[model samples]
Target chain A: MTATSPTARTGQVASAQPSARPGKRGDRTGAASRAPWLLLAPFLALFILTFVLPIFVAVGSSFTKVTRSGLFGEAGVKSEFAGFSNYAQALADGSFVASIGRMLLFGVVQVPVMIVLCTVLALMLESASAKWPGFFRAAYFLPYGVPGVIATILWSFLYVPGLSPLFDVAALVGLTPDFLGANTVLWSIANIVTWSYTGYNMLIIVAQLKAIPGELYEAAKVDGASTWRVALSIQLPLIRPALVLTTVFSIIGTLQLFAEAQVLKTVAPTIDSQYTPNLSAYTTAFAYNDYNVAAAQAVLIAVAAFVLSFAFLKFTNRKSS
Target chain B: MTATVTPTSTSASPARTSAAGTRRSGSKGRPSTIIVTAVLVVVALYFLIPVYWVVVAATKSTEDLFSTNGFWFAPTVALWDNLAQVLSYDNGIFIRWFLNSVLYAGIGALLATYFAAAGGYALAKYEFRGRNLVFGTILGGVLVPGTATALPLFLLFSQLGLANTYWSVLLPSLVSPFGLFLCRIYSQATVDTSLIEAARLDGAGELRIFHTIGLRVLTPALVTVFLFQLVGIWNNYFLPLVMLSDSGLYPITLGLNNWLSQVDRLPEFYELTTGGVLLSIIPLSIAMVVLQRFWRGGLTEGSVK
Candidate 1:
């Protein structure tokens, strides 16, 4: 990656010699090498200011603890260099640990369902001999266009028993389950997620499917293969990269699940305040004003997310490479 | 670009064989194909029904919303009334949130896309020191969850006296590492380097070459990145939840969330919240319709080339 350059690729494609071939390469070497760096400077500047610097601050803050006790009858706010105090407290807190476990459980159930639904839809769309795959693709992707907040609200209406026609139909069929009851709220959230994201992930898989050379399918047909076999053997394998990409995204999104769950709390009061790790962190920082502890909790959640993502990447990359 | 001119090998072979098979296959199973098409249409309708409900529901008054057939035609007209109430409520703050969302999504996506295009173009088109290192760092940024970043960003912004302001939301929205990665990949595909070098050789400065040649070549990818960022920023609520205190600065997302919370106390808010949901979706739908061709074209771009 480092050795390849636009100049070299251009030269190769054009079959042209560098203006001064091997001998005078030094004439162009110094200035030519600096151009990419100069172009990258502004991005790097913003990255440091907004991303890298804030991360360092978080790490540093995560190691400290706050206490208030003695003063000249004053509000004695103090920060101490208490190594791992915040982390220990965060890990030990029942709610924090419970939220992490809950989110992992949520992701475990939701991500697979989402991936399967998305893949099936993508396959169905790609396989259609119909005249309107374009229109159907857009229709499937429409929910992805709806903002999460808006989608959650829309789903809530459908979930409310009396208001939703779907629910009314269910009632007529002798299934009178509440959508946002204590027993079913998580699935309700998962439903909203699958609805919003199926199209988004389907687009990725469909794009990957479209990338597969038509020659492979023709060759498969010549070998007496069926539509299902073509899909199972060639199309699935070819789109594995995009599947892995969508899986990683789903994991991250499932972990950060907030909007739908938060909105559902309106209808379902039984949803505990800290039902997910992100919600817990938000409550800690904004509602509780425990910045240090919140920072520590955030770092832990982030590390967990990083570990899962990196493990996925490493496994996939090793196999692919 | 040259690849398009290179005789398409894959399609030529398939088209020859599939052409004959299609005619035979169509004669044998036309009915099943129709059934399949019907099934697909049903699935599509199932997916789109809620949106239709919202539109129709938005048009009905509170009484008619429940009294009318839930799935289809409304019994009354209340769209303008609901919209007027939504706008005039809380002193027209919903409009403010709409504007804030536009600013946050529009400006933030524009800047984010520019950074992504520039950084991605540079990475794609140049050989430089520590390039992999820089890219690896950006990839690392993509993996870290946004929820984790929110608390830390809040702390940092508080330290800088920037919390609870527009910048808190705006600044974070500009840092889309995935968009940068996609842009880099897309730029690598679309932009030919000889055109760039020829321009440079013709005495164009780096910025001028970038603006005149590189930017034009990068259009498709930039639009993709921009659309991604726009959807992202529009859906972004956790950041504002952590950053903003004043309801006056709320995006429609946060505003709707506030409305949602009060629905239990006031059932009237259910209608307003639903109406707000319907209203909120219009911008994104419009965006999709206008940009549909661009998005589809962009998605298929890298796959073939």
Candidate 2:
């Protein structure tokens, strides 16, 4: 299948080499070049229909509102220019503020822990003397392979009070801390996120580690400095780009913390309808059936994500530079 | 962590004197290796224990799950029996949900990977007008969370009369901006410009060059993107939750969520949901094992460049 397609095309093109030596050859070739366009057509059409057009429609619809007249309120409904009313209403909602606060807190707490854990794991895996580092690396990376939903579901079972073995162990120790309670629920979600993602970030850092020409480590070893000193000076500075990449991804993922909370909310009733920013938007859209409000909330979330991430990158870039 | 560091300079000392000296030191190696291996095993067990418990819990009836030991021990020979009950429960709707999940993720990832690869290849190789604009737009797209896009996409899909259909779920999955960004980066790193020019000089068409040479060198990235999109679509709950209304269209995540909601009413659903969760993981685990090599190379290479 692989060899036949390319070789046959090559053979045909090779055999047709000496066909013509006139202006007509250029014309024929130009017509033949259209074949590539034919091949690319399906992908282009799909892309436009699915991606490009939707954004345009969404942007346009965000500005409009549906209204009906009195005494014939149900008879005729028409789209009216609402200006910024929807956006204003969404901003006025209290849950939106709380959800944003929750996400900010999640980012503040989760991103740093994940980054530090990943860095430490990478350092351990990259240390020259560490035995079976590859085995450890793969084992650490195992959780990342599980789909996020499955990971959350699996963790939910573990977090469920009586069902979880962890809970059982806690009960045995006579220190049964409620993992899914209101006080620690956020952190519980954070723990799940940390578990799923720490290894993924570690792999990113390890890749950065591998690319750091071994000579640097060799040079560091030659110095009188200890392993900690070498890592602090050499490895940390070198892997800053990968660190930034993971940080940005972590920020985005933290903002979109729906699956974990949604699954847990079922078992742990303490998780309110609007536990996270995305959940707020989801409930507004689906549960309330308020499409206009939901659209407004969506735009607000996007703007918030954009500003926070953009500012973070700008600040980090400035400080680093 | 602190005690593990040992300076290699002393170990590299050339001598009978060093060998005689370190013969005593070598004896401690056994205890340290044991400690390290033990620590690693503990961590691995930490990773696997929940999954292990879920499997064991799925096998036992409700009575055994609580009555027997927490770990998977004897006294629960109901593995097949529980599986059968799960399959037949609610007129076998669990199986339908499983099939729905496979369709959403399996087909969705395939098409999404295709679009992402092609789009990424174009951005990497071609010099079209507005190239920077397109690329920058995609970069912007990468930063926008999918959850943020869900409402807008739902409204738009509803307007198009495509809501609650397969296309509703599949269409959004196909336009993964992050996957596109990765592919663009991967292609830029992997595909050789000189070879492309050479292929063009040999009178090969552009599409032919892309399929034959471009995708060949891009196998590693393609695999990575496929795995990423696959896992992503499989785990996707928010989109399916928002888009599909019919229970028949629910992916395993959403389906299990729906089941989890009703588990309080019917405790039998507890076993079925756990079993479904276990089954849901099999494809992903197999995918991981099959494609683990690609992940190492893909991620390592993406970072290095």
Candidate 3:
């Protein structure tokens, strides 16, 4: 678990409503005491059944081996303990290893660009002089409502040479962008992601910017700080929490990149079955019929996400404190 | 759109909109102002083009889809024709998918919202013995990615003969750790203890107190949790893709992808696929606009404490 797993990060703030209970009030009323347990039982039971048990099942199954009598594992099969072999095999697969590396590179470049872009857009739109902030925010945010599969389908049309007016416009200027080429396809997918998400991340930062007391800006203005100076000295430092939250979320999202790549597999030759860690695990389980090995790969994907997000929260928390 | 602006300071249209222009300091025509406006306008167009293209392409026949420009309307608008085809294709599977999405997102999110509210209000109000342990364990669920859980859940569900069933997807969609987390924070911050105490003192039963007082106070937070989980479940692809083999149970995402994967051999699916994508997003877009405030409030509560 993260040190400040988003929820626990914010315990104390200026509550708009006043409450008299500072310490835990010693109340052992008859019906009230049992109500909490009753209320919490269904959610807690479902949470464990879905979230907790699967994790244990995945880890437990990851260490097992399955042997089948028939080709394609269509006949009687038995599962036995596999030990660390699945982990070893997953790591040794060049494509699986490469997919993890690809995600790391993707996260490194994409997360910062998104955070900075979102922050800048939030600062600008929330600024006093900007016109139609609501309209622009909606315009930017409209894409997040479009599902990833839909977004990719829409973009692929633009990328295909004959279909898009964008291509026609680019051709007149003596430039032809091969968006589906092996080398450029990854970045083209990145463009789709960037377009879809920038507005959402910007909205989070805008919420944080709105939470800042109006008196802080008034005080800064009284001191004759230029807009640029105020943004740097005050706004940036104060919004670090939002930045950290967004960064962690982005890392998790990038590591789980599957739907876009899966949808693009037929059109883009560069993308294969094992183009991402999630996709690798998926293909291993369903197509190759290796649930035990697929479990290991899935476990590794989760571990990588945890490691990355934990490291980020650690780094940010240290600097902030 | 209009190039003529008198800068009288009264009328604030979007043409006055720029990245960094200060209508505040009476500096309307600053070079930075033009740069801001131009830059933002261009970014807006970037986001708008794909959406506009989908709308245009949805109006074309399958033949026109290939022959005409992707961004422009065809000579004749076949939008109604395409709509009819998309809805009626394969015995109206698209309608089934749309309804499936609504059912999954609607009922799943409502249950999730209620669960989060009830559980969160408990953790916020009660001083139980295992409160921290239960709450802390639930928070750990937040770190587990959805894909990780899907594989094992699919495996388990298959073992129990539940795979390819609606329960396989709906059961998982019912749990939202992030929503639960947000609910706790919002409840803690918003739900005052004295109000609950007074309600209890008014001879109200515990469940009644929760229904009348606790839930009433946590209404905004509940809405926030609902919207997030609604979108989360609606936008979900991996679960349904992994859980259900039956196209009858397919949500829009999986169904659309299924259509996309087949477009090369059966070229006529192009119109159906594009038209389906256009129709799927219509409700989501409306929900985004209507529930925009609640979402912002949700983010502010969790992100800015």
Model number with the top TM-score? 3
Task: Give each prediction's DockQ, rounded to 2 decimals.
Answer: 0.34, 0.29, 0.41
Native contact fraction of candidate 1?
0.53
Question: Candidate 2's error at B169, in angstroms?
Answer: 1.3
Q: Cα RMSD to native, each candidate?
A: 7.7, 7.5, 8.1
TM-score of chain A of each: 0.87, 0.84, 0.89
**Which pairs of residues clash in candidate 2, taking residues 3 or more apart in a chain or in different chains?**
none
Give me the overall lDDT of model 3.
0.82
Q: List TM-score per model, in order.
A: 0.89, 0.86, 0.90
Candidate 2 stretches greater than 4 Å from native: A1-52, A69-73, B1-39, B72-74
Between prediction 2 and prediction 3, which has the larger DockQ?
3
lDDT (C-alpha) at residue B41 in model 1: 73
**Model 3 residue B256 lDDT?**
89
Per-residue CA lDDT of model 1 for A1-321, tens digit only, reads: 234455554554555566336324443555567777877777788787777887887888889887877654267778889899889988888988988888888889888877876776677567634447788888878888888878888888888766788767666879887878887888888878887887888887887887788788778778877555676789888999889989998888877888887877777776877888878877887788788888888888888887887788899899977
Give the alpha carbon lDDT tens digit for every residue of A168-234 in model 2.
Answer: 6766879877888888889888878877887778887888887888667666555645555666788
Candidate 2: fnat, from 0 to 1?
0.35
Please state the error at residue A283 of candidate 1 in Å: 1.2
